[model samples]
Target: MPIDPMLYETQFFGFTPQTCMLRIYIAFQDYLFEVMVAVEKVILKKAGALSAVQVRGSTEAFLRFMKQRFDRLFVKMERALLRLVLSVPPTVLLPEDRSHERHPQSREDFRLLQQDVERLQGRYKAELGARRALLAELEVQKAVRAQLRKTLRWLDGLGDAHGPPGLGEMMSLLIQHSGRLRSITEDVAQKSSGGGME
Candidate 1:
């Protein structure tokens, strides 16, 4: 920003301050795109299916607005920068002008850009790790549910191959047990009554 456009034009042939500013603008645009991509991937990976769809829909709408706004800004900036570049007489860039590419402001901007990339990369890595854990937990739950279902089905299949016992079957079992118990109780009573023919 400190680089005066007129100063650069007089000093450098091809490289202009406006060109550097354009590149900075381009970097900002690229940064936004990168962030959007990372956000989309994280949302898709982290959210449930229904929530992900909803989130994606809303995010897409927001992204459309952002894209439109940035696109307009870019077009305007490009037009102005290009006009300035064209008005300036074309000159051959010197070796010194090449060093100007590392201008302090540009260097600081690029440094911040790099930091942003690194930060986003870290977020993506963490999201992927969390997703893996979530998937593993889901798999375990699915396996447990499958086992439970199988056990329930096996329990339901107990008794006979034809079908489970009905009320009639339960009543029959109860009657048979009661009949034996009754006979034993009567026998015991007869013995306690001295076992003589009564």
Candidate 2:
């Protein structure tokens, strides 16, 4: 079950959750003690608290423990925090950092990665250019086909109504096709010369 927002609003700190608590540890001779500080009391957050402690020691052995013990502990704590954060069906409590995720690499590895990336981009662009050129040619072919079909239909109508077309009719047909041919040639040439795809 999900916790109610209104219930949280009434029960927990106001809207912001910045207020926290800290627990400090002190060691003297052979004894150790802890102190807790409540920051929420001053900040208006009423429920829940956070705690962290700094260990200090007077004896040589205790001082060494204070200095040496926490390094591994800190590393473990950070790793645990990271795992907990990444595992959560993430919410505002955690922010994902995808940009800086890095793998161990040598200079040669990095150089090879760059080269591979550039090669891939080059191939992709070449394929893309070829695809665009093919599409343009297809469009040109379609227009030419449509023009040819119109001329063919006209010739078929003439043959159906009477017989095979004569000199005058053929001349008119050629004139019409010539205009369409010229347009088709211009379109092909423009595309070949790197003009805008039409």
Candidate 3:
């Protein structure tokens, strides 16, 4: 059979033993304690009321007494219920999903979590940008080194054909610069290896 929503609604609090009698007893005891305290204060206000001869009250009289005190107690309970309803988390009222999202205790906690996520996203983006720049610089240095080697090869061919006087000096300078570029590229590759994509 389908569940009857009209007969049964959701309850936030759970009770031990889970019996209607226990629920009624707990409700009566809670209100009765407050009512008794209020009655004691009222009796205390009237001088000698406590010291007077205690009379056995009829059931009707006790019921009437409780009826009068319960009015204010009921209003107080209503206000408390309203506050409890308002303070309930929105997640509790919604249908459950299969996502791995954690439920925060309060709005402030949720806001702080959002801020932390945004901070992590920004940090990740910055690291990625730095890595990309390093890779680009490394690639540029490698291309420069290769071009230098190609030019030196062409110079060797010209030297074999009895080229100009300053050609030897130019080849030596180019070789030294090429060696320096190779060292710089090696250093850059080593530094990038930790966080490099390549």
Better of 1 and 3 by lDDT: 1
After superposition, candidate 2 runs with Cα above 4 Å error: 1-104, 162-198
Q: What does candidate 2's lDDT look like per residue over 6-71, in tens digits? A: 333223333311111111111321232221122323223443343222111123345457556655
Candidate 3 lDDT over residue span 1-198, tens digit each: 752222111343332222433455568867776765666556656655444234223333675677667666755764465445423444553234224255435788789989999999999999889988878877766676676677667657755676554867777867867776677567656655645345
- Winning model by lDDT: 1
| lDDT of candidates 1 onward, in order | 0.68, 0.51, 0.59
Instruction: State every prediction's TM-score relative to the real structure.
Output: 0.31, 0.35, 0.35
User: How are the candidates ranked when ordered by TM-score, highest leading?
Assistant: 3, 2, 1
Taking all chains together, the TM-score of candidate 3 against the true structure is: 0.35
For candidate 3, the C-alpha RMSD (Å) to the true structure equals 14.8
Residue 105 CA displacement from its true place in model 1, Å: 4.5
lDDT of 1 by residue, 1-198 (tens): 363456646455556666676687889878887888788888878876757678778778878899899888887877687566534554555676656655646778899999999999999999889777666666655565565566446545655564667889867855765675565555545444442221
Give the CA lDDT, 0 to 100, for residue 88 in model 1: 57
- Cα lDDT for residue 192, candidate 2: 56
